[model samples]
Target: MQTINLLLAGFQSAFELAAFITVVVGLLVGVIAGALPGISFVNAMAMALPFTYAMGATQAMLFLGGIYVGGVFGGSISAIMINVPGTPASLPSTWDGYAMTRKGQVKRALTIAVTASATGGLVSALMLTFLSAPFASFAMRFSQPEFFAATVLGLVSVIAIAKDKPIITLISLLIGMAIGTVGVDPLYGQARFSFGIPEVESGIRFVVVMIGLFAIGEVVDLVASNRDLRPKKTDGKPERVRLRDILAVKGAILRGTGIGCMIGVIPGAGATPGAVIAYGVEKQINPRGAEFGTGVEAGLAAPEAAKNATTGAAMVPLLTLGIPGSAATAIMLAAMMLQGVNPGPLLFIMDPSMVYTIFAAMIIANVLMIGAGFGVAQMFSTLMRTPPAILAAFIVVLSLIGAYGVRNNIFDVYVCLVFGVLGWAMKRVGFPSAPLVLGVILGPLAERYFLTAVANSRQDYSVFFTRPISATILFIAFVFVLWSLWPTLKSRIGRQPA
Candidate 1:
């Protein structure tokens, strides 16, 4: 009871006038950055970090945390309206969100998005506030063997629920694992895939690869699609959406939140896998989920909840183990470090107030998003009213600016244009771009673990399976891989079902 009382009191303490003002400004900045294609949450935080130098740690945390939460929810607005996801996390929202737009229920879809996002974000924040210490304690007790086991469990579990083609998913996972090997081996200094290039020795920059696969690849893929093949003019009217329909997607909301929270616990795995797994689970559990491509609010609700829930859950890694989850969290972690705030177990003991403040700010941002998001989306909706010529030029310039802002480098700009074309072409051939992004993000982690396990066993192949946790995780991975290959193996023997 005392713990409960203290937590509620802590929430109240967040009402300082200064914190309130920071929340307001953060909301506005986050709204705009989130709606702008290619200007992801990470970039927004990085861009704003310079200004935060003047503020105290608590004050700066309020602004950064507020914007982080708001930006995530903000992506849903443009995703639903434009058929273009403002952030990678918004991809699943586009499945039904844009369909709802075509059904002329844009406003209603937006409302459902807001409601689900708020619910998920709020719940996750509360969970993080009260449960973080315990979770952090648990994470601290994990040894390398346990860590390896956990990592293996995640990959195997994720593969089980990935896209329709498990075989394809494994192939993608392996490709990622292989890419992870490109850098210097953690156990020994020898490089495997550097090809003797100095630039490659530091290894492929994870951020650069993400920028390429997600940001660049998406643009290329979208542009390659023949404009004529786009969905017809069934865009929904603002008023067509009903609260009843939003309420009906409750199952998706609940399922998505659970999945998002679970996945977010993994350091380096955040909303991307959460969204994909949520979408996949919704397909199995909800009747409407199977009808997703045909257009359904349930589909939108599931991904919206999953993606936004991850916003708060991703903080768990950063706060607990000083490890970042998603790329956005990576940038946030860096920003905090720049301000001289080290995030670790000691941070919890030494700066409880500052930690509580961030927790409070997270909740406040979700609340602010409800009102700020509506206005931002409505104003930006005027984009639909703009002529194609004007919009095209605007998109081009905006994309260029976004690419260059990553490092003010022209090389990235070329990468974006090239990937944009590639992405467009890939979609034409029925290939999904997400696997490519996942391949890039997970590539490194998989490689490090594999090499570490091998070295610990003195290059023995069985060392990875020696520990109880590691063995369990490896067994699961083996099962998952074989399960994915089952049908293919059967088909080769002429035993496939019709």
Candidate 2:
């Protein structure tokens, strides 16, 4: 009953002119930003941060939440249309979605992507609405050790994403962790790898690294390959999707949503891993598994659902424990802090209206995304008529500006360009960059929690395993690593001469 009342109040608050307008504007910005290569929704959120200062706390949450919901779905637009993912989570879309586009079934591919995305996001938003309070209560019992264990779980989950290529993934992850260690020590406050550069002491921002790694490399590929951006026509008629088409993939959407929600609740896991893991799972179980990369409908539907599903689920830890689940949520954490609001159990008790309003806004955003997504897709499809060189040039300039905007520092831009070159090189070699980005985003948080946990236990290493919750989480992570590696080990053993 109380939950019902709160929801009613939330709707009342969210429907007000200012709040409604903010959500609509933010949703549009997010969709446009996410549909454009190199301007990820995270970048859009970061750029929108300063503007949030002019709004009230609840309005600001509504605005950012709207963007969060819309942006996750928007990336699939470019992924399906251009063979280039607008965001890291959209990587799986290119595998099958672009294949569909090549066959001139672009409209059908997009319809599957959008419908699955909206379904996943809607379910996730509802979960956020009802589950966060109880989750917050559970989180109240967490200590330093528990937090560290959760972070470790998130870190190891990346292995599931790598499957048989763990070696390269580990290398990429280690490189990111090393980069994360460059700044001042979390405990001692003494610089480790600054080398006397003042800006280095403050640490490299993940936002700059993300923009450079994802944006610049993609644009360079566009310019180098002179890729065609125009969609292919199929007998001068557009493919139409019907309700029956969506019903055919209901199971895939459900599975993807489940995976996404589970992954997203982890303190450091985010949409990239969620989407990748879902694709892997779908490939394992679907009857068309062998034809996964050949534009299977399940292939396009599952990851699209998973990526958008993570949007609302990622908000769980952020709202409950004040822990950011991904780089995007980290930006939201910064936004809240800037507004003199701290999320956690206290926020729920003290500002139920704000919490529920944000929930309502998430629901509203996902509901509205169907229209917003198609509108942006239509606009971008038309814009694809532009020359590839001109689009690439614009992407490059916008990416650089996003990098520089991190702290309004030119040094960050230099770092971004350097990483951009490295990212391009990595891509040419077929190396996975997603794991590296994940490590950069999560490594510092893991370090902070690990150090704090050890200190709290008076340097006792057993503290992580002595606690039941912490031990269980670590055990699960250990089992996950073994489970992921067993297939390769079994295959290798079977290949040995008998």
lDDT of 1 by residue, 1-498 (tens): 755655565567678788888977887787788877767776788888888889887778778787788888777776787655677677667767887777667777888888888878887887788787666565554445555554555455445344456666667557656665676877678887878865556554334444444444544444454232122455353255566776788888888888777667666666766776677567656765337644687778877888778878888878877988677778778778878999988887787777777888888888878888888888877776776445555666777777677667676577567656655565567555555555555555555666776676677876656666567656766765576455456767796455
Model 2 Cα displacement at 5 (Å)? Answer: 4.1
Q: Considering summed lDDT, which 10 consecutive residues are worst modelled in model 2?
A: 133-142
lDDT of 2 by residue, 1-498 (tens): 898899889999999998999999999989988887656788789889999999888888888888888888888887888765777688778878988987888888988898899898989889888888665556556687877776676577566556457799889988887888888999989998999999999898776777677667767666667766566789855667888988998899999989888767666657876787688677666877667767889989998998888888889889888988777889899889998999987888999999999888898998899899999999877776788777667667877876776678999999988888888889889887867876886688789989998998899999999999899989977887786677678999999999
Q: What is the TM-score of each candidate against the true structure?
A: 0.81, 0.83
lDDT of 2 at 361: 89
Predicted structure 2, TM vs. truth: 0.83
Local error of candidate 1 at residue 203 (angstroms): 6.5
Clashing pairs in 2: none
Task: Give the winner by TM-score.
Answer: 2
